[model samples]
Target: MASLPQALPEPRAAGPAERPAPPPVARVRRRRRPSGEPPPLPRQLRASGRWWLGLSALVLLACVAVVATGTIRYVDVADTRVLQAIAEIRSPALTAVAEVLGLLASDPVLHAIWLVDLVLLAVFRRWRHLMVWLGVGLLVINVGAAMATTLQRPRPFEVEVLGEWSGFAMPSLPVTVLAALLVSTLYSLVPPGRKRTVGKWVVCGLLVLTAASRLYLAQDHPTGVLAGVVLGVATPLAAFRLLTPNSVHPVRYTRARPAHLDVSGDRGAAIVRALRDQLGLVVTDVSPFGLAGSGGSTPLKITVKADDTVRADESCVFGKLYAATHVRSDRWYKLGRTLLYGRLEDEKPFQSVRRLVQYEDYILRLFSDGGLRVPQPLGIVEITPEREYLLVTEFIAGAREAGEAEIDDAVIDQGLGIVRRMWEIGMAHRDIKPANLLVRDGTLYLIDSAFAEVRPSPWRQAVDLANMMLVLALRTDAERVYRRARLHFSDEEIAEAFAATRGLTMPSQLRRMLRQQGRDLQDQFLALLPFRLPPVRIQRWTWRRAGLTVVALAAAAIAAYVSAGVLAAPL
Candidate 1:
C-alpha cells in the first residue's frame, strides 16, 4: 500500500520563459530594418524613480529662476559681446593655456580639495557622506553668495583679465559652486553602477573645464558661467530629494555572515532556475548551506538532483536559497521588531518576497502534515520580480545542531514531541532557537519553520516552551533541562515560560538568547518557569486612538509650556 512522496506544485514565479532568444550577432548580421517591434529600448527605459526626481526638480526650478531674474539681462549685452570677442581672439598659445586652466580649476585649489574632502568625511564616519557635503555645501555656497550679492553683476574684461577673480557676478561661483561640488562629489564618491556612469561624465568634464576657464579668463559673463552650472546641477539634485534613506536597511552593522562564503555566485545559477521553475525540483547540483544571516537576503546552499521524476527515495534534496536578493538592512527587521514589541512574528502577515516564500512553504507543509519532524518542503521558487525567492527543503540526512547535540534523554524526548505536537495543533514555533534544532538519525528535526504558527497562542506557546527550555538549558543543566521540562511543563507552565522573557521582541532570536543565556538564566528561569501578572483595565482608546490622543495631548501641552517658560525666565 505504498503511495506518498508527491507534495510539490506551488509555482507562480513565471517570467523569463515565453521563449524569445536568438537575436544577437548584431541582430542577425544587420538586415531586417522593416520594423518587427521587439526593442523599444526596454520599453523606454522603464522610468519610475519619480521620473528622475521630477526631472531633477524641473531643472532646479529653472536654474533658480534664472539667477534671480534680470533673466541674464536678455543675454547681458550678448554675453558681453561674446566675452569681448573671445577676449580678442587670444593666442599666446591659447592665452597661456587659458592662464594655466584658470589656475588649475582654482577657488583656492578647489577649496583645498574641499577641505581635504571634509576631513576625510570626518575621518570616515561618513554620516551619509557628511550629510551630502553639509547639505550640498550650505545650499551651493550660501545661495550663490546671496545670488551674487543681490544681483550686483559687473565683471567681464577691464583688461586682458587672465586669472584672479572678485565677486558680484550674479552666478559664476566657480560655475555654480564647482558643478554642485563636482556633482555631489561624484555622487558621494562614485558608487551606483558603472562607477556612477564614469563619475557622471567625469563631473561633466571637470565642469566643462571650469566653465571654459571662466570664459577663457574674461571671467564672469557667459551668464555667469551659465548661471553657475545651473546652480551646480541644482544643488546635488536637491540634496537627493532631501537626504533619501527613509528606508534601506539590508542589515549592515557588520559581523556574523561567515559560514564559509561565495554568498551566492551566478546567484547559484539563478537558484537552479528557482528549483526548476518554482519547486518542481529538476535541479541536478548546487550546494553550500547555512550561515547567510547579515541580511540583504543571500541565503544559499544546494545539493539537489531530483530529475528522473522523483522517487529514488524522493531523490537527494538539501537546499535553502531564500535570496530575497540578499535582504539588506533586515528588510524592516521583523517589521521593526513587530512595531516595537507585542504580537510577535508568525511569518506571513506580508512583507512580500512572495510573502516570504509563501510563508516558508506554509511552514513546511505545516510540519509535514502534523506528524511533526520538518524539512521536506522541496519547492517554491520565484527567482526575481518583487525581488527573488527559493525554498527547496528535505535536507536532513543525519542532522546536527541543538547546539551540537548531547542534551541527552533522547534529545529530551524528541524535543518533547516537537513541543507537544505544537500545543496539540494550536501551533506556534516563534523561532525555538538552538539553531532551529536538528539532531537527525536519533530523530527531532524541526528546521526553521520560518516562524511557524496556527493560532490559539499562549504567549506564542510560551515562546516555544521558553525557547526550547533555554535551548536545552544550554546543552544540559538547570536540573537536567528542568527534569525533562517537568515531563511537559508544570511548575506553572514553567513560570509562564520564564515570564515570556519579559515581553521578548528584542528579536534577533531573542538577542541570541540573551547573549548566550546570561542574567543567570533569569534567576534560574524565575525559580522554575510559569508566571502570573493578570491585572485589568487600561482602555484609554478615546474613540479608537483619537489622533494618537490628540498628538499626545499636544505634546504634553507643549512640554508644560516649555517647562513653565523655563521657570519664568528670571535668572
Candidate 2:
C-alpha cells in the first residue's frame, strides 16, 4: 500500500510584488487527436436505452392505432404467413430442441432469474437497482394485462395450435416478462464494459430463440412476440440507464465510498487544466489524500510544480472535490435529519453541486474574515459546469488530528476560545468533532467548514461548545477542561451548553469516541458545572415529519415483503 502524501507546505513570508504570476495559456483551435486511444462515446449513444424506450412506445402506439381503426386484419395476414413459413420446416428433433430452448422464457425460469437478481442486488446492498427492478416488474405485469384485455387478439387461426398456451396472445406476456428480467439483470448485475457488450448479444440470442419457438409452435403471432421483446427489454433498460447510470452508481465490489469519483484519467486531466486555467496553479500530481478518514468528499492534496514564479513552500494545496453524487447524498442526509429531528435549523437540501460548494467557500471566507483559526480560502475551481467542483484552501503543514495530538493548557484554551469566538460571531461549526479540529505547533485550526452556518440557533451553538469540550477532554480530563472553559464561558452559559447537549445533538464521531472511552463524559462535565439544567428536548414532531415517517415506513415494509417473496418463491 502507498503511504499518504505530505500536507501542503506552509506559506513563506513574501512581499506583495512577489505574488505568483498567472500560468501561460496556449490556445489550440483543434489539436490533433491522440493516437491509438478510442474517441469518447457520445452520451446518447453510450446510454441508448432511452432511444430504445421511445422506439418501443412508438411501435406499441402503431399497433394500438391499427387495432382501433379495424385494420389489424392486414397485420394478422402477415403474421399468419410468417407462422406458416416457420412451421413448414419444423421436424420432431427440431421441435424438441425448440421446446427445450423455449423453456428459458418460461415462468419458472424467468422467476428463477428474477429471484437470483433480487438476491444479488440485495446482497450487494443496491437498493436503487432493486427498487427499479420491482417497479419494472409491476409495470410489465399491469401493462401486459391491460394490452391482453384491450386488444383481445387470439392465437393464429391459419395454423393448427401445436403447443400449450393461455390468456389472450396479442402481446405474449411470458416473452415480455422474460425480456424485462434478463435486461434488468444485465444492466444491474453486469458491469459496463466488454462483458456488458457480450451480455447484450447473449440477451438478443435468448430472445430470438424464445420468439422463434413460440412462432413455430403456433403459440403466438409474430407481431405479438415483437411487441413483447420491445416492451420487456426497453422499459427496465431505460429506467436503469436513466436512474442509476454507471458513472454514479457503479457496480463495484469494494468498500470504497460511492461519492468519491475516480480522478485518474480524463477527470484528473480536467482537474489539472481547470486548476491552471481558473486558479493559476500548475499541478504535477493529483493522488487521493487521506481517503481513509474522509467519507463525505474526496480529499485531494495537489502537488504544484515549483518554478521561479511559484515558491517551493506553496507547492502543495488542499482541495475537496464535490460532484452530483455528493449533492444527492447531501439531500438524502438532510432529508433524513429533517424526518428524524423535525427540521433542526437549516436542514434544507442544496439545490445543486455548485450551490453546495459555493456555500462552503462562502463559509470559509466568512470565518477567515472574522478572525477564526481556519484554513485560508484559496479559491474554487470548476472541473465541469454544474456537475463537479474543486474547493481549494490552504493546508496546514505538520498538523495532526486534535484527538491524536498531545494537548496542554494552551491547546485547551485555544479549543475553548474557538467556540467562544464562534458564539461571538453568531456562527456555529455544526460538526465540532475531533477530525475537523487540527493541531499544528500548539495552535488549533478548524477545517471542514462545510457544515458551518451563520446566525445558527442558540441550541446549535451550545451544542458546539459541548462537543468542543468533549473533544478537548478526550486527551485531557473533563474537570480540567471545565476549569478552563469557565475563563471563556460563564457558569450559566456552561450549564446551558451541557443542557443543550445530548445523544443526537453531538456529532456521531464525538458520540462514538465517548462510547469507546467507556466513560460518561457528558455527565462528568455536567457534574463540574455549578448547577444542572433539565435535559433539552431534541425531538419535535410535526405534520411534515409525521407524513415523511409514514412514507419511510411504508417503503421499508414494501421492500421487506418483496425481498422475502423473492427469496421464498419456488423455481
Candidate 3:
C-alpha cells in the first residue's frame, strides 16, 4: 500500500534557462505630422473672418449713405427737366411709336403676356425659375410704389390725361410693367443656351416701344420711364443673382442607411455612421427585425442611446427614409417594426408618408402648436449605407388590445373627443381602427398620423365617425355606445352620420351581430335611415316633455306664493 506500485517520477520543473526568451517585440513606427502646412479650419468657418466683418461694415455704410441722401431735399429740378423733355418730343412718328407701345403695355396685354410666360415655363419644367422671376417683378412694382411715395413726385403738368388716375404717379405703372416684362424675358431667354436670341431681340425692341408709348400716352414723363426701367432691371437682376442656383450653397445631406433590407450590398456600416452623425445617436446594435413585405417594406431594429439624455416624454430618436420609398412595402414594413419595437418613451411616428423625415417633423411641430394631441416627435436619424432610418419617438405604454371589453370608458370618450376635434379642424383620420388608438395612464391617445388628410369631405367625416362608432360597438352594446356619443353630439346628427355611412354597412353589420341578443335595435336603425321616420317626431316629443316639466314647476311656485300672501293678509 505504501509503495503504491511505484508512482511515476514527478515531472521536474524546467529551469529558467530552458524556457525560451519571449519573442523580440516588434516596434511600431509613429508617423510624423507634416511640418509646413497648418491644420485647416472647420468648413463652417472657412471664410476669412476679416472679409465678412469688412463686408458687413460696408453694407452698413452704404445703408447709412442711402438714408442720408434720401432725407436731403433738392429743388425738384429733375421733375422740371423731365416735363421740359416731354414737351420737346411731341412729333408724329415718335407719337405713333409711343401709342403702340402704350397699347401693348395695357393691363389686358400684360396679363396675356404673363399667362403665356407661365404656360411656357410649366411646359419646360422651369416653373420654379419662373416663379422667382414673377416674385422679382412684384417686388419691383412694390419698390417703385415706395419710391414714388417717398419722393411725393407728381407727373408732368403738360400731359392732358385721357383717363382718371389715382395715387402718386412718379414711378409710372406702364414703365414698371414694361420693365418687368423686358427683364423677365431676358432672364428666361438667357442661360438656357442661345436658342432664344430672336426672342431676346424682340424683348429689347418691345422695351423701347413700351418706353416710347408711355411718353406718347403722356402717362409718364421720359425721366419717370427711365427710372422705372432702371428700377425694374435692377430688381430682377438682383433677384436672379440672389436666387440663382450658383448663389445657393448646395446642402449635402449625409447619405442615410437603407431602411429596408438591401440584398444588393453591405449598407450596414454606412447606416451606422449616418445614425451617429445625422441623428446624433450612438447606435449600440442593429439587427434585422424581419423580412421585407411582398412589395418592398422591410422590418429592422436599431438600438441606440442619445448623445445627451432627452426628456422622459420627449423623443430621443427619429426615423428617416427617402420620400420616394417611404410608403413602399419594403420601407413601410421596416419603419413599422422600428416604431413598434424601438424604445420610444413619449415620441410618435409622423403622419406624412410623402415627405422626408425632416419636413414631417416640421409639420408635426405645427400640429402640436395647434393644440392637437400628438406623439412627441424626435429628430430623424439616418442609418448609413442601408438608407434605413430610425425614428425615436415617445414610447406609449399600456397598449391594450382594441377588442378587449374592459377598456376604460373614459378612454373611449376621450377617443371620441379627439375625433370631434379632428372634425372641427377640417381633418379626418382616414385610418381609425382600434389599433391606432392607445390608452396610457387612463388617458386615451391617438397614434399613426400617416393617413391624416386635411379638409375631409362630409362623406369622409361621416365614415371616420362611423368607424369609431363601429369599433366602440364591437366591445360594448350599441345602446350604451349611442348614449355616450349623444353626450357630445345631437341624436339627429348621429343619425345623419349613420345614414351617410350606410353603404359601408358597418352599423348594419354591428346591429346584426347584436340581433342574437334579442335586442330590438331595428327601430333605432330605422331612425338612422335617410328617409323620414316616426322616431324624428318622438325625439321632438321628448323635448316637449321637458318643456312641460318646466311649466309645471313655475305654476307650483306661483300657487305657493299666493297661499302665503293670503295667510299673511289675515283675510
Candidate 4:
C-alpha cells in the first residue's frame, strides 16, 4: 500500500526535533575521518612535487648565478666597448627588424592585447587561469623593475634608442616582459597536441627573434638580456608553486572524503560537538549516501543513538552539509546559474552555507504548514563560524526519483498540489525536476529547496510549473503532462509560463533522459508557442552606466597614449 496522504498525520515543526534511534545498517565501509583537512594526495603527485621543488630551486639558484655574472661584466666591460662590438653585427635590415621586435613586445599595443585577453578570461570566470598569468606576469615585471634601479647598469649605444627610457640597463625588461608573456601564454593555453605544439614553437621562435634583435641593435649588453630571460622564465615556475591548487588534476564534484568526519581534526571535532550540543542527537556512525556524489551540498546518511551511545536504536537520519567555500569550479557554476535566467530569477543564490540551510529550512517548514510532505527539518549544526553548516532531516526510506518511478495519476496530482501550494504562497521552487522529486511508499516528497524563494514574480512561478511539467513528461508523455497542467492553467498562461523556457536550464540528467526517449524538452516547448518570442535582454542601458563606460574607454585611450610615448623614450 502507498504511504497515503491520510496514512501519516502532518507533524508541525516547533524547533529542532531529536530523531529516535533505530537499528544500524551493516557498514560496507568504515572510513576514518581525515584530520579536518583534505585527504592526503597519493604518492604520484607528492613524488612529482619533490622533483618539481628541486627544479624550481635550481632555477632560482640560476637566477642568482646570472646576477653574479652580469655584475662582473658590468664592472669589467665599458658601455662604449659593448656598443662597438654589437655595432659590428648591425645592418639596416637587422636594425629595422630588431626595432620592430622591441616595439612589438614593449609598445602599448601589447599591453592592450594582454588586457583584452585578461578581460576575456575574467568574463568566463577562469579564475585559476587568470591568477596564473597575472602572478607570473607581475613577478617578472616587478623584479625586472627592481633590478633596473638596484644594478644601475649603463645602456650601450644610448643614441640608438628610438624611445625615451629612464630605467637602468641590466635586465632589459622588454625582453623580460615579452619572454614571460610568451611562456605564460603557452602555460595557460593548452589546445590539441598538434595545434598546441605549433603554437608553442611559433611563440618560442618569436622570443628567440626578440633576443637576437635586442643584442644586434645594442639595446642592452648580452648579459643584461640574459639576466632578463632567466628572471622572466623563473618567475612563472616559482609562481606555479605558490598559486596552483594542491590537487594537480582536480575532478569535478568530488565528494569530501570520509576523512572530513574524522573528529580527530579540530574542525571535524567541532562539527561533531556542534551536532551533539545543538541538535540533541548524538551521532555514532557517519557515511556518504550511496546516491550522493559530488554536488554543491554534501548529503550523508548519519546513524545516531538517542542516548548518545551505540546501545539505542541506530536511527538513520539524512544530513546535508553545505560548505562554507566552494571549489573554483563550483564558484564558477554559481556565476553561470545567475547568467542563465537573470530576469526570470526570483532571488540571489545562497550567499553562505548557513544562508542555504536557513532558506531551505524556512521553505521546508512553510510547505509542511501547507500539509505538503517534505523531509522534516530536524536541527542545524554549525561547524565553523558562518562557513560550514549542516541540516539534519528525517530520511524518507525506500524513496525513488520520480523520474525513476512510474508517474501515475496519483503522482501527477501530488505534483500539481506542490505547484498550487507555491502559487498560494507566492513562492517558487526554481529547480523542480525529476531528481528533486521523490516518491516513497506511494507518497510524493520534494527535495533540494535550496533554490526556493518567496514572493516570486509570476514568471518564476510559471517556470516552476513548466519544470514540473517537464519532470512528469519524463515518466509519461510531454503532451500528457501539458494536458494535466491545463486543468490548472489556461492555454495562454501555460504558453507564457513556458515562454520562460526562452533560456531554460533543463538539468543535464533530464536532457539525457529526454534524448533516450527521443523527445527534446526545448523543441517540445517551442512547438507549443504560436510565435517566436524575442530574446530576453539581460543588460539594461542607463545614463550612469553609459557614462562609466565612456570614462573607462577614455582612460584606456589616455593610458595607451602615455605608454606609447614612454615606449618611444630613449634612456
Candidate 5:
C-alpha cells in the first residue's frame, strides 16, 4: 500500500499583528449654568399658587350666595305651577317610582338596614366603622328634629293629598329623613371614580322624587321641603368631612371584677345576694372562679360566683350584677343563636325573653336527642324593664383541662365513626375543633352545636376530618396517624378527602415542629396514596400442529446437550 502523503505541516502561528486600540469613548459634556442664576421653584408649588387663590375666591362667592339666598325669600308660585305641570305629565311613571322609593324610606326598611350594617361590622371586627355609621344615623335623626322645630313651616295649603302624615309640617321630619338617607345611600353606592358625574345624577334623581312626594302628598310647601332636603344633604356631608376620626362615640358594656370591690364586705355581698332575693335561688357560699372569659362581642362574663341551690330543681343561681369600677375593659360574647345579655337592672319585663328561653331550651333538648352530651339547661329568667336575662344550666364541673399529651388512636377512630354516623342521619357539625370536644371521665363529648346544619356534604365531612386529624397530629406521630387513617379509608378516598380539605394534613404539624426545633430533615415521605388499581385482562389463544412440533424439537435439543455434557465430564 502506498504510504499516505505526509500530512501538510501545520501552519506556523502568525506573528502578532499590531491591533489598533478602540477609539476613546466620547465624554458626555456637562452644560454650565450662568454664575448668578437662582434655583427654579418646585412644580407643585407653582401649580398650588393659582389653585389656592381660586379656591378661596370660590368659597367666598359661595358664602355670599348663601347669605343672599337666605335673605331674599320670594315665594315662586309660577315655578310651583311648572313643577305641578311636570308632575301631572309624568304622574303614572312618578307614582310607580315613588312606590319603590317609598319602600326605602319606610321605618322598617331603615331599621333593617341599620341592623344588617351593625351585624356586618361586628362580624368583620370593624369597631371603628360600626361607630361611624351609628353616629351618622343618630346625627341625622337629631338634625331632622332640630330643623322641624326651628323652621316651624306649615304644610302646603293648596295641593291635593296622597299620603298620611303625623310629624310637624316645616322641614318635615319624614322628608328630612328621606333626604339624609338618600345622601348617605348615594355616598355608599357611588364610588370615587364616578363621584362627580354618576353620583350627582343619582342624588339629583333621589331629591326630585322626594320633593315630588312631599308636594303630591301636600306634606309641606315646596320651599320648606326644598330647604329641608338641602340641609339634610349638606349637614351630614359637612359633618363627615369636618369631624375628626376620634370624634364619634362608641357603645361599650362593663365587666365586674373582684379588685373593684371588697369581696368580704357588704358591698361585694350585694352582687351575688340577688340570687336568693330576686330569683328565689339560694347561695350556700361564694368562691372566686378566676378571671371571667368573654368572646369580645355581646355578654361580658365577670367574677362568676358559684352558688348552692336550696331545692333539687334549682341547680344554680344566675343574675345580672352591677359592674365594679376596677375593671377597665369591655368583654362580651355575641351569642349567635340569641341575644341573652345587655339591659338595665331597673327596666321591667325583658325584651324577647320568650324567644331567648325557647332557643336555650331547644338547644339543650336537641343535643340530648341526638345522643350528644351537653350542659343541662335548667331554666331561663329575665328581670323586668332592665332587659337582663339569665339562663341557668348544669355546669360541667372541672378545672381548665389541658389537652392530652397524645390523642388516643381509638378516640380518633371513634370520632371519625361518629362523623360518618352523623352524615347517615343527614346532619353536620359545622364547627368541629379540639376546643369543642370535651374529654370528661375518658369519654368524648361534642360541645357548641350552635353552627350545626342539616345538610352533610363530602366537602364538609372532609374538612371536619382534616381538622380532627390536625388536632390529633399535634401530639402524635403523623405516619402512625396516616397509617391508622388508611386502615379504615382507601387511599383514593383519603386523597379525595384531603383535596377537599385544601391540602391540610398532619405533615404540616411535623414541619412546624421541626422548624421550631431548628431541625432540617426534609419531609420526603408521602402521606396520601391512591386506592384504585388498573384492571388486568387474560387472553385465550388457538395454536396449529406446526407450533407443537417446533416446541418438541427445542425440548429434545436441550435434553441431548445436557446428557452429552454429563458423559464427557464423567470420562
Candidate 6:
C-alpha cells in the first residue's frame, strides 16, 4: 500500500564548463526472487526419466547382442590386454589391497549397506522414496540375474582369478547393486542442490574404485562392469527424479507441518506471476497465514499492489493453495470416512486439483450471492495448470475467530442467523467450527466453504445447527445460547439437531476445543430441551466399503512380507 519516493535530478550550475547533466539514476527496489528456475512439473520429470530408461535399455541390449554374436573380435582382444596389464604390476601389497576392495564390493557388504538405507528411509517416513528404492533394487537384482544366466558368460580367461566368483560373469550383480544403492541413498537422504551436486562426485569416485577393483582381481570382464554401472545408475536415478521429486517431497530435517508447503522460493515467485497474469492482480507479497488452524491447504496472505487497473483500496486478499498433494489428502480423507461410515452424505473424493479449487470458488460465490455474510469471491489463479491453483477471496481485516471475539447477544443471533439462512437455501456448512467462523464490528462471517454442500441431507443440516450451537456455547454458557436459538427454531427441530449430531459429526478442531472445556457441552445443550430423540445411525454397511476393507488388508499383508524380507534376509 506504500511506495518509495523517486529520486529527482540535482540542480546544475550555469557555466560554460558544465555540459548537459546526465539523467538522474532511477532508484530501483529489487524484489527477492527465487535463485533458480521454476521446478519442472511432475509430468516433465516423468518424461525425462522415461527417456533415460529407454536409452539405458537400448545400450544394454546392444552390448548383449555384440558380446553374444562374437562379431567384434577387437573387443575381446582389448579386454584381455587390460587384464594382462594389471597382472604385470601385481604385487603382494597390491594384491592385499585389491582383495580388500573386492570384499567391499561383495554381496554381504552391499546388502548390509542396502539394509541400512532401508532403515533410514523408514525412520524418516519417506514412504514414497522407500517404495521406489525397494522397487529399483528388486528390478536390478532379479532382471540382472536372469540376463546373466541366459548369457552364461564365464570369468576372464588366461588370468588368475583372485577374488570370489558367482553364477555367470557378464553384467556383474555386485556392481549393479552398489550403483543402485548409492544413487537411491543420495536422492532419498540428501537434499538436492549444492549438497547433491557434491554427492554426485563422491558417489562416482566410489563406483570407480569398486569397478576398478573388480577388473584388477580378474573377477569379471571389463565390459561386464560397464554394463552393470549403466543399468545400476540409470534405473534408480530415473525413479527418484520421477517419483519423489525434490520440488514436491523435499528431504529436510525440520519440525514444520507437511501439509504446509514452503512458499519462500520458486513457489513464491510462481504465485506472484500467476496473480498478475491470470487474475490481473499484482501481488507485492505472499506469506503463510493462520497455518496452525489449517491442515487441508496452505493459507497465504497476498498483498496486491494498488494501480490504475486495480482499485486503490484493494491492498490484500486471502488465498489458499490447492496442489496435487492436497488432492490426494482429500481422497484419503473421504475414503477413510466412507469406510468408517458408508455413504455418509456423499463422501466422494475430488478427481483433481482443478475440481477442488473450482468447488470452493463456486460455493463462495453461491453463498455471497444468496446474501450470506461470507468472504467475497475473487476468482481462482492457475499456478501450474491442473497441478496447482490459488483460490482468492477478500481478506476480512481486523477480524478474529468467533472463539476469540467477545460473545454477546448480537453475536449469538448472528451465529444462529447463519445456520437459519443455510437451512432456507437447502445448503449446509458441514464444517461449522470456531476457526471457520469470524467476527468483526458486531458482524459474523463464515469461511472455508470447501465442505459446504447444496441440497444437503436433512441429517447434515441438523448436524450443522448442532455444531454451530456447540461452537457458540464454548464462548458462552449453553443455556443462554440455547434460549436464544429457540427464538428461530422449534423445540422439535432442536431435538432433531442433537439427535443427528455426535462426536463424529463435529470437526476435529471443534471436538478438541470442547474436550478442553472440561465439561459435556453437548449433553448440557440437550438437557435444556423438553424431550430427547433416539440417536441417528450414521454407519451403514455397503458392498463398496466391504471391498475396500478387503483390498486394504491385502495391501498391508504384502507390504509386511516385503518389509520382513528386506530387514531379515540372509546376507
Q: What is the C-alpha RMSD of each candidate to the true structure, in Å?
A: 20.1, 7.6, 24.2, 10.4, 35.7, 12.7
Poorest stretch of ten by lDDT in candidate 6: 7-16
**What overall lDDT goes with each candidate model?**
0.58, 0.79, 0.50, 0.61, 0.43, 0.79
Largest TM-score belongs to which candidate?
6
lDDT at residue 183 of model 3 (Cα atoms): 65
Candidate 1: where are CA atoms >4 Å away?
1-134, 137-143, 150-174, 185-189, 192-201, 204-206, 213-291, 295-466, 469-488, 494-571
lDDT of 4 at 5: 29
Candidate 5 global lDDT = 0.43
lDDT tens readout by residue for model 5, 1-571 = 2222232222111111233222221112223334563211101223333443355345335434644676313344543564466456556666666666555455656555555555655664544344445556566567666655554444444455555565565455665566665555443333333553587677778678767665654555665565566555664454333331111111212344222222333323432344343334444544433222211112212223233423332233222222211111121122211122112101122124344444446655555555544454445433221222344444444422113433666655555544544555556565565545555554455544434555655556655655555444545555655666655555654455555443222224333444564522222112334342232111122232245446667866974564344223210
Error of 3 at 198 (Å): 64
TM-score, cand. 2 = 0.82
TM-score of 6: 0.84
In model 4, the Cα lDDT at residue 296 comes to 55
Candidate 1 on 386-424: residue-level lDDT in tens? 545556666665577776676677667567557766787
TM-score of 1: 0.31
- Compared with the true structure, model 3 gives a TM-score of 0.36
Q: Model 6, stretches more than 4 Å misplaced?
A: 1-58, 64-69, 72-76, 99-105, 307-314, 563-571
> Across residues 1-571, which tens digit of lDDT does each residue of candidate 3 receive?
1121232222121011132222121212323325563221111222333343354345335434544677322323554555556657677776666666577767657666666776676665454466676676566666666767765656556456433345566566556766676667666545533544566577767778777666655666565666666655556555554443311111112242333434212345555555555545565555553232111233334555532444432222223233233444324443443333332111234443334445446545544544454556655544422223444444443445344435545655765666676677677665565555555566555555554566766656766776676666566656666666666555555665665554322334344444555554434544543453222111122333455456767876985574344223210
Report the error of model 5 at residue 320, Å: 14
For all predicted structures, in order, the TM-scores are 0.31, 0.82, 0.36, 0.54, 0.37, 0.84
How many Å off is the CA of 20 in candidate 4? 12
